[model samples]
Target: MRIVRAGHLPPLLRLPDGHTKIPGVPVGPLLGIDATARFPEPELRLAPGSVLALYTDRSIERRDSDIRSDVERLQGSPALLGGGGPDDLADGLLRDVCHASPDRADDIALLLTEYAPPRR
Candidate 1:
């Protein structure tokens, strides 16, 4: 799949075997600031049962926490790796990460997609 991300935050991809962080290329700049900004399209061949997660910065940002460590924790989260639907996983992530802080300054948004090949 071709995933083109053009912002400051990157996304996460979880496969049946492992998980990884998809890095976004440094595009010209954030949208609206540069109308002519061109982004690089990174592509990947996702295996069946792979789960892709796209989240906003608020999902990981905190007042006094290391984002890298939080990301690592998120990758190994049982809720993310557990057997559940996209909605369930999203809720779990939000509860485990964002909801822990009640003084968050920004809102969180998460989108999860699981890849399932067509059945014969």
Candidate 2:
């Protein structure tokens, strides 16, 4: 799973007041898997409403038909968000593909999520 350190969190080592008086540079880590090397702690931030899509390599293997059309058909469906979460959309897409296939011969995994900023 992708991991990120949010905000100006201090290091594990600290003083009694739980504050870093030593004015150290605060950093956040961003990580990704696949082709590039995974960053244990990446320094990147995402704005609100940002959508992160993580799909298995099999996502491009749906042959015998137009892949874009297949994806559009699922995205345009009303039941895509039945679970009240973006993750449901991925599940719905996979389910549609699996059901359409003659037999579920391959494994599929998909994750879609929207990043919402924390409310103060």
TM-score, candidate 1, is 0.80
The best candidate by TM-score is: 1
lDDT of 1 at 28: 41
For model 2, how does the per-residue alpha-carbon lDDT over 25-118 read when each residue is reduced to its tens digit?
3434433333454334533344454444444435434567675555544444343434334566556656665666646567766656666677
Query: Clashes in each model (backbone N, CA, C under 3 Å)?
Result: 0, 3
lDDT (C-alpha, whole model) for all candidates: 0.73, 0.45
CA displacement after TM-score superposition, residue 43 of candidate 1 (Å): 0.9
- For residue 85, model 1's alpha carbon misses the true position, in angstroms, by 2.4
Top-scoring candidate (lDDT): 1
Off by over 4 Å in 1: 18-28
